[model samples]
Target chain A: MIRPGSTLGILGGGQLGRMMAMAAADLGLRTHIYAPERNSPAFDVAAEHTVAAYEDEAALVRFAKAVDVVTYEFENVPAATAAILGAHAPLAPNAHALAVSQDRLMEKTFVAELGIATAPFAAVAGETDLVGALERIGRPAVLKTRRFGYDGKGQVMIRPDTDPAEAFAAIGRAPAILEGFVPFEREVSVVAARTAAGAFAAYDLCANEHRHHILATTRIPAGVSRGTEEAAFEIARSIAEALDYVGVLAVELFLLTGEDGERLVVNEIAPRVHNSGHWTLGGAVTSQFEQHVRAICGWPLGATGRLGRVEMQNLIGDDAHAWEQVLAEPGAHLHLYGKAEARPGRKMGHVTRVYPESD
Target chain B: MIRPGSTLGILGGGQLGRMMAMAAADLGLRTHIYAPERNSPAFDVAAEHTVAAYEDEAALVRFAKAVDVVTYEFENVPAATAAILGAHAPLAPNAHALAVSQDRLMEKTFVAELGIATAPFAAVAGETDLVGALERIGRPAVLKTRRFGYDGKGQVMIRPDTDPAEAFAAIGRAPAILEGFVPFEREVSVVAARTAAGAFAAYDLCANEHRHHILATTRIPAGVSRGTEEAAFEIARSIAEALDYVGVLAVELFLLTGEDGERLVVNEIAPRVHNSGHWTLGGAVTSQFEQHVRAICGWPLGATGRLGRVEMQNLIGDDAHAWEQVLAEPGAHLHLYGKAEARPGRKMGHVTRVYPESD
Candidate 1:
């Protein structure tokens, strides 16, 4: 088991990695951030950093050998990279979890196989497959590249007027999955953690809002029924247990309200801390970042109790320029990622507001 | 004015500096730590670090030039070191605050001059001065070196039978002070902050307990009367205003309960983030460390509302070895300074437990 003084090696160097490094430091652990970017924000707060690409086998081997254990901020860690690191040190959430979550088709298949509800999806390996899948799933489906898709990128919405061949060509003819639109009433997620010893813990369900395919805000008490919330957690626990996951993972679910009652469909699984969980930073007894560190270190999980009614809004791009105003507001907690450029759609920081639960 | 993304130069790379650096980074600021020790705990978290003596003029100038502003974690920053840094960059709390707090005689006189209650004190520069001061202050006093005394070092107890001369020699006959000890009921502190605009905010008064001359635990509500708490805040405000202080300052006070009422006597001032305020890390709406950064950067002070009934316990030496047990305790927040060894009496970590306030 990794002790408090052991070194924790992180794979990515973005805001998530930065927060994780800070959490690890709070537990008296040293951090070594490994990223390909020269000016990765995580490097500023880490004790050590290596600016090397994930594909660089020599650098990856050296990094693995230097730390007691390794974890990544992003789920799309290359299988070869995970293999190399796992050979040298423990790589958690484990390689299987990454492989399962990396591809949309595989992720959906895995969820469906667990007797959980998931959006109807089919593999589209070629143009013929796209047409065949489209005929079966109908129009208004989203054709997404099976791998390396994020933030509304690498995907196209198929409409009645849109040509299947044109849509396939738009995505560079990559292997893809066509998901039938679920028309969800609300987008909610479960951010949870599991230890190697099978100890599982989940935060309260949070409702998420997205703008331009980017997550904008997350609010707790997702306003779902108690049974629906429990169902979501069970889905997450089962998925984690299936993968033998040993870190924080997030499951985004669509809440569909019908004539009967509320229903939930699994959208996707993030094999790492998700932006939707940012509310836990100050709104819960234990933050998701800290929980991740504890689980990966083979330690006991912490309390998942909520502190108050919470809302977390992302400070995107130029929105961060209003930080002075935000700082002036009483009881508003502001967190900014140290990124110099304010390119539109880029995440610059975030603000979390927690109100006392009214009696 | 210094802004987020600006580099904050910090001196004395101890746990206080480490926490301050982490808080600064949360606000999007980078930190550069300068300390004489190569393995200083703060070095692990800062963006840049210089392992050079505080008296190294060239290194001090370089560090000052490399950052937007300068602050120190300890009160005993040498006059020359402050001067050099001030010439190159703005120094928060200013040099006068440091000079006054560094010497016991000056600190007591300053408080007394402000029409505040203080222990009866007399300056003792030599053997004759010590005898004269002892005669005036009476026995059962504390004879302490005027400067560089901390953690019960450079101070001796003067009992009725104890020889004043012998006590002076035991303190190395350094420039000293003789203070008539007060029979106080409890030790309390006001951890507050002041901005350049003269805006000030104070956390709730906290009662502290010490073991072997080191802080052991701090609890909020202080068990003091409302009037006494107000008086402590007034005392702290007067001192901060008098010094033109900008940044966090902790005023240690003694709360005395008498037949008439409760009275407060000023003990000393710490012109930096203090151990007594550690409870605020998770116990208050905004932590003392974050408040210090805001004050120094010419930003508005954050809210200081208490989250609950809070208690912070320091883990000294081998006490930190029980971290696994603490982690297992739900809702307990643990913070460990990245210290390798558990040497006797050294602060290794801390645990904070916050209970919801009863209606």
Candidate 2:
């Protein structure tokens, strides 16, 4: 097991990696951030950094040999890269979890095999398969590329007037999944951590709202029935156990109210820390970042107890300019990602506000 | 005023400076740490670092020119070093605050001049002055060097059988102050912050317990009378106003009970974040580290509200080896400073537990 003062190698250099590095430092662990980007924000806070492309096998081998263990911030870690690192060091949330999470068809098939509820989906490799899948899944379906899709990218909404050929061409004729759309009452997610010994802990269910296909806000104690909340946790537990997952993972779900009251349909899974879990940083007894570090190090899971009624709001585009005003407001915890540019629709920072629970 | 994205220059490279760097990063500010020792812990978290002697004028000038503002983690910052940095960059808590805080005689006299209640003290520069001061202060007094003392260092107690000359010799016959020690029930402190605009916010009074003159545990809502708690805060506010202090400062106090109930006597002042305030990191609305960053940057101070009944325990020496066990504890929030050695009496980390306040 990796002990305190050991080095933790993190593979991706974004805000999530930056947060994980900070959490590792808090636990007395040194961090080495390896990223392709020259100005990755995580590099600023890490103890050491390597600026190299992911495909640099020589650098990757050296990085893996230098650290006690390896972890990544994003799910799209190429299978070849994971294979190379795994040969040199232990990679938590292991290569199996990475492969399953990276492909939409595989992820959905895995969930279905476990008897978990997911949106009806079918693989589409050609124009004929697209029409066949649509006929099987019905109208108002989402045609998404099997790999490298995020924040509504590499996906197209299929309507009654939409042509199947046009939709396939729009996505560059890539291998895709046609998912039958469900009119969800709300979007919610469960961010949980699992230890190698099979211990699992989940934070409270949180309701999420998106704007322009980007997550805008996340509120905990999601306004859902107790049964739905418990079911959400069970789904997360089963997924973690099946994947033999170590470290943090997020499962986004769609809350649907049908004749059976309230039910949930699995939307997708992020094999690393998710933006929706940022609220746990200051709103829970143990933050998701810290929990991830503990799990990946083969340490025990921490308490996922929520502190209060918490709401997290993302600062998108030029919204970060109001940081000064946000700081002036009482009880608002502001966190900025240190990105120099405020490009349109880009995430600059976030603010978390926690209020007392009603008596 | 140093804005978000501006660089913050920090003096000292201990745990306090490391935590301050983390907090500054949370607010989107870059940090440049300068310390005399190479491989200082703070260097791992800061964006930039300088390893040079504090007396190196050329290096100090270069450091000052590279950052927007400067702040120190310890009161022992040399007068010449402070002047050199102050000449180039704006220093928070200013040079005068540093000079007064570094010298015990000046700190006591400054507090007393403001009509505040501090332990009775007199400067003793020589044997003649020591004899006179000892006679006036009576027995059970402490004779300490006027500058550069901490963790019970550089002080000698003058008991009934103690020889005045011997006590003077124990401190190397340096300039000192004789203070009449108060027979108190408990040690308490007020950790607060102030802005350049004169705005102030104070956390709840915390009672402290020490083992071998090193802080062992700190509990908030110090079991003192409400009146005494308010008075302690008043003392801190008055001191901050007098010094025009623009950062987090801690005021240690002795709770004394006589025939007229209870009162407080200021023991000393820490011009930077205090060890006793470590509980704020996980137990308050805003942590002392974050508070210090906000103050020094000329930004608005965050909420100083306590979250619960909190207790913070220091992990000294080999106690840090239990980090894994601590991580397993359901509600314990463990924070380990990235120190390599677990030397006797060294502060390796701390664990904070916060329980809901009883109505």
Candidate 3:
């Protein structure tokens, strides 16, 4: 077992890593953040930091040797980097999780093989394959690159009037997956944590709304049927057990309203703490960041009980400029990532508001 | 008003300051910690730090100039230190608060003058004053130095047979106060915060138990009558308004049983966050640390609502060695100060356990 005072090495020095480091510190564990960028926000709050490329084998070896366990903030951790670190220390959410989540085709197949509901998808390796896959998946499908996609990036929509080859070329003709569009009623996610001992705890289902391909708001008690919520949790548990996951993972699903009331179709799996789980920081007994730390450290999972009715809003781009106004509002917990610039479409911070339930 | 991007200067580099700095970062503010010790625990988590003597005018000036506002972790701030910083930037909790709380005689007089009840106290400046005060206050009183006392230090008990001169000399014959002991049932504290606008909010009353004069455990709901709790809050409010206090302040009081039921008498006032308030970190809607940052920054006070029944236990000396066991316990929130050594009587960390109220 990883003991207190042991250092946990984290890859990627963004706000996610910064929050993870803080959670680790609260558990009496030290954090070492490794990133190539100078002024990485995580470095400011960590016990130690190394500015080096992920491909730098020597630096990776030294970082792994210095820490008791290793985890990463993003799913796109290069396979070679995971191998190097795993050789020296325990790597949580393991390399298999990274491999499956990194590729759109593999992720869909893995979820489908588990007898879980997923949008119909086909692989596209070339223009011919794109045409064939487009025919199989039908119009209004999404052509996403097999690797390096996030926040609606590395993908193009294929509508009835749009050309299949053009859509594939837009993604640089990389090996991709064509997922048939699902006109769903709403998007919901199951943010959960799993320990190596196979213990699992999931937060309540949360409804998510997106604006301009970016998450704008999240509300808990998603208004789905009890059956749908239970099914969502079961899907998450199966995914975690299959991956042998040992950290917080989020499963975004499309809640389709049918004759049966509500049906959930798996959308994607995030291997690390997700933006959708930010509400847990103040609205739940234990935050997803802290849950991730506990799992990675091989500790018992904390209580996932919700505090009250919760709503979380993201402060994207210029939205964070009104931080002073937010701070003045009572009952609103405003959190800002220490980023120097307010570039468009950037996630600068978030605000969570929790209300008491009616008696 | 202090803006979100502004810097917050913190005095006294201990766990309270460390948690306060973390809360400042959460609200989009940067922190600069100033302390005399070379390895101050707070420095590891702060954006900037100054290692200098509290009496170092040059360093204090530079620190004050660098930050937009200043606050301290403890009440024993030197008058000259406050003056130096106040000249350069806004200092929350103000200078008068420091002056009043630093000296036990002044604090008691101020509380007593406000029509609030306090343990009968007399100023003892020398052997003559000690003898005169002891004769009047009688035996079973505490002889405390007027300034710079904490955790039962700088105070000696005057029993029935102890010589007054010896007790006075033991405290170095410093200007002191002889406080008439109250036959109290329990010790309780009100951790409250006030803004410059005169807005005040207090957390629920907490009952404290000490081992060897150091805090061992703190339980919320205090097991006190509602009337007693209300009176305790009124005392704290009057004190804050009297001193024009801003930021979090703690008022320790004795819960004495009267024929009418429970009554409270003022014990002492802490100008900054107190150990009794540590439970707020994970068991309240807004932690005392965050409340202090919000008040100092001119932001609205957050909700002081408790999450559930909570118990906070301090990990002193070798007690911190059980950190791993604590981490493995479900629902236990462990907070370590990153102190390098576990010297006897030193506070190394704390654990807070919160239980849901039974319906």
Measured by DockQ, the strongest candidate is 1
Using lDDT as the measure, name the better of candidate 2 and candidate 3.
2
Evaluate residue A302 in candidate 3 and report its C-alpha lDDT on the 0 to 100 scale.
85
Model 1 agreement with the true structure over B13-85: per-residue lDDT tens digits: 9999999999999999999999999889998888999999999999999999999999999999999999999
By DockQ: ranked, best first: 1, 2, 3
| Candidate 2 chain A: worst-modelled 10 consecutive residues by lDDT | A350-359
Full-model lDDT, candidate 1 = 0.95
Error of 3 at B148 (Å): 1.8
Q: Work out the TM-score per prediction.
A: 0.99, 0.99, 0.96
Q: A217-293, model 2: which lDDT tens digit per residue? A: 99988989899999999999999999999999999999999897999999999999999999999999889999999
Error of 3 at B25 (Å): 1.2
Off by over 4 Å in 3: B357-359
Candidates arranged by TM-score, highest first: 1, 2, 3
lDDT of 1 by residue, A1-359 (tens): 88988999999999999999999999999999999999899998999999999999999999999999999999989999999999999998899999999999999999999999998889999999999999899989999999999999999999999999999999999999999989999999999999999999999999999999999999998888999999999999999999999999999999999998999899999999989999998889999999999999999999999989999999999999999999999999999889878899999999999998872
For candidate 3, write residues A1-359 as lDDT tens digits: 88777889999998899889888877767789999999887876777899999999999999999999999999999999999999999999899999999988999999999999999999888899888887787888999999998888999999999987788789998998899999899999999999999999999999999998898999998888899899999999999999999999999999998777888999999999999999999898889999999898888888898888999999999999988778777778889988888899999999999888651
Error of 3 at B290 (Å): 0.9
lDDT of 3 by residue, B249-290 (tens): 999999899788888899999999999999999899889999
